[model samples]
Target: MTIKQHQSPHTIGRNFRLIAGILALAACAKPANATDVFRFEGFGAISRGMGGVATAYDTGLSGMMTNPATLSLMETGSEIQLGFDFVSTDIEVKNKATGEHVSSDSHGNNRHPYFAPQIAYGRQIGSLTLGAGVFAQGGLGTEYGRDSFLSRASGNLDTELGNSSRLLVLNIPLAASYKVSESLTLGAGVDATWQGLNLDLLLGADQVGSLMGAGRVSGSLVPVLGGLPDLRGAHFSLTRNSPIKSGVSAWGHTARVGMTYAFSEDTRVGVAYTAKSRVADMEGRATLTAIDGVAGQIALPGDITIRDFQMPAVLNLGLSQRVSDKLDVAVDVSRVYWSDVMKDIKVGFVSDSGGDINILLPQDYRDQTVLAVGAAYRASDKWTLRGGFRIAQQALRGSTLFAVVPAVPKKHVSLGAGYAFSERASLDFAWSHAFEEQMDNEGTPNTSAPIRVNHSQDNVTLVYSYRF
Candidate 1:
């Protein structure tokens, strides 16, 4: 393996290490909502069946995130549910112009796959019910080709540009579903969810020259200017730590109220609402280490930066109808305030050199609205069928913050089924496909910077839900 040589270190720095560029890209990875939690439909069954259970979900512990109101409605008794999730995904990136495939695939790359486990348990006593569960909200892991553009052209010498992140949120809830009268049932739950995120950004030799788009330019070669003598063997490296910080989220506390009204002998209508929490305080560290032997070693002090983050509230409405002795159908409609995440991220820092730090997050995307429609049917005495669809706008299609590492969007079709084997237990399975979409940031019309990018994601998930 060989690293190319250049006449000037500035051009070399621009064309080679792109070490600064790496820092810029790394900056974007830690958003106010840095990691994803509470996925669209976490388990395979919910996904394959379209996650339409907002109104008629099983009374298991997993129902807290979807609709706490359902707590008063169903009976799971003393049941314990446990399962694991397996995921596999593929990504294709290209250049918008000339239909060129700029992103490398055969550079010895592997698809994204992971194992996640979760459990839910619930019990009722008198008019009060209690539930608790440990489950991952949602997250993404993407580490592609070691020989890709970002890797080959950069100064990592390690020869790769890799990044991955995982996040999980735990929900502990207590509630009561009271029978106010013969025709009505009223219920409520206090929700407290804990959040956490883990992130990593890596670079190798292959990613060096690619950072500056590797063209050509020349400059004076000397060590006295406080820069590398040339762009070749001088050796340069930078490692940064995202300072350590812990948060007991302010917005994790809220109240939920739900009411179920009996319309007739076989029909019921339910409505539920919950107050939103004030989410803020994203404080973290920024420790940097720099080595430019050609220009001499220079290490920057660690900096502390914080951002104020917020999340929108949610509302759900659902209905359940019994059609025959062996059949029933259910559907639900829900809304989320994605617009709350529409602002650019901002950061304030305290420089060790006695200077105030201030920087604006470059996120300039529109608020989003999502629509979920799903259903489940007991087709026979021993079998149940489910299907559903969901649609939401993409925030990364053409944003100012496009990087070699991309963010995933949610939009797909799902199908699933379940079988009752005996009086004590049952089995279920589900499958889905997210429709592909194209992206290009360079030529989106009227932009000074001309960097082009295009990509899409494909995914598969499997899980198991049990009753005892």
Candidate 2:
């Protein structure tokens, strides 16, 4: 046999891998949010539908960062996929005073129906596979009406009163996997991460004083809190609008490495480590609006900046097993180093009269562990069904949870399905819902009285793929 004839198949695979690499890199860009404070369990429709079980299982390019070694399982040809997710989130805050109990009315808030997009491609050659993708990894945000009960309690009568936040990370991962043996593969990737943030806040002076502590505030704030005869029992309302007034964005880079081992034809396990993306400070526009029943109104022009903002590293492990020809199951566990990057949220503002003001909101967040399990069933050559469950430990508690980000839910249920339209094309769909969870802090030093926040979410994802 001639060498050219023997190498024909390998040559074709190499060409396919090169074409896939070019397409994947050319399509890399931004998209938009998922899990934790703004972290997602999975990146594509198949994985999300399977309760984020991509770490060990082969789910096309979506598993690159989760476990790049999964790429070695791909077919010799090239494949491309695009996915979109629609997310809805809800947040509620309740305040308790001596005689008054008020809950935030955020029904039909209309801030949700968020859209996130993702794309990826992969190809296999002789013993190597290469790929790249753009994924919207994580984000958090909430919206409330101006006439909500919380707004009224905060003393907003002339204008709207609400607090909202948007944190998004776009990751571009360039990855390669090498098949060391028939059952073992190793892979690694470099990630270029882009992060964006927008914060709109309205806090009562009492709440601010509690969070900032008395020592951090100037003596002038004491008189406004009720020392003056005309200002007794009077409160100041602080307003910060950053999304529209002033926007904040930053870019950083990180990397991940992983390995996958196949114990048998029906079982496999994978592990991976992702480094933190160190980003710059986020600066935006802010205004402090204080409404005093006795002194009328006070507005201060300032800028809001949060320093040393970063995303923490993660360690992930996964296992996948095929119980039968028709049934497959997978599980994943992850440890998130939140305390490394979220120890404190420092808010600094510079005003025309007050000069420079700095407030340190202590997060002291604890590390979190996430668990996920999923099952997929192949009923027929053209039809597949999937179901999954996921849960994560809370990173913060008590007053700190309510004072900072309070929308991290603890549990989720997911369902998904796939249909093959042709020999080379398929459609996938997934739906996941987070159960409502709440945390309450009663008379904590970080909060004057009692404060509680409730949160939940619903997500739908769809993707289309073609292989050649």
- Score each candidate by Cα lDDT: 0.44, 0.69
lDDT per residue for candidate 2 within 149-172, as digits (tens), equals 344423334335454455667789
Q: Tens-digit lDDT track for model 1 on 1-468?
A: 012332344543342243234223322221211111124443335533654355444424556555554555545455444544434344444434334344423221122123344566666655555555555444443433434333222232333333333333444555566656545667777766554433323322122223223321112222221243423211111112222222112235556677767676567667766555444454444432222324433333434433554444557676767676544555656565544553543434443544443434344554444555666676765577777776665644365434333444456666777655443334455555555545555621111123443333333323333333
Q: Model 1, which residues run further than 4 Å from truth?
A: 1-38, 42-48, 56-59, 97-113, 145-147, 151-167, 181-183, 199-256, 274-306, 347-357, 394-397, 404-410, 443-468
lDDT of 1: 0.44
Lowest lDDT block of 10, candidate 2: 231-240
Task: For each candidate, give its TM-score against the true structure.
Answer: 0.66, 0.81
Alpha-carbon shift of residue 110 in model 2 (angstroms): 10
lDDT of 2 at 61: 79
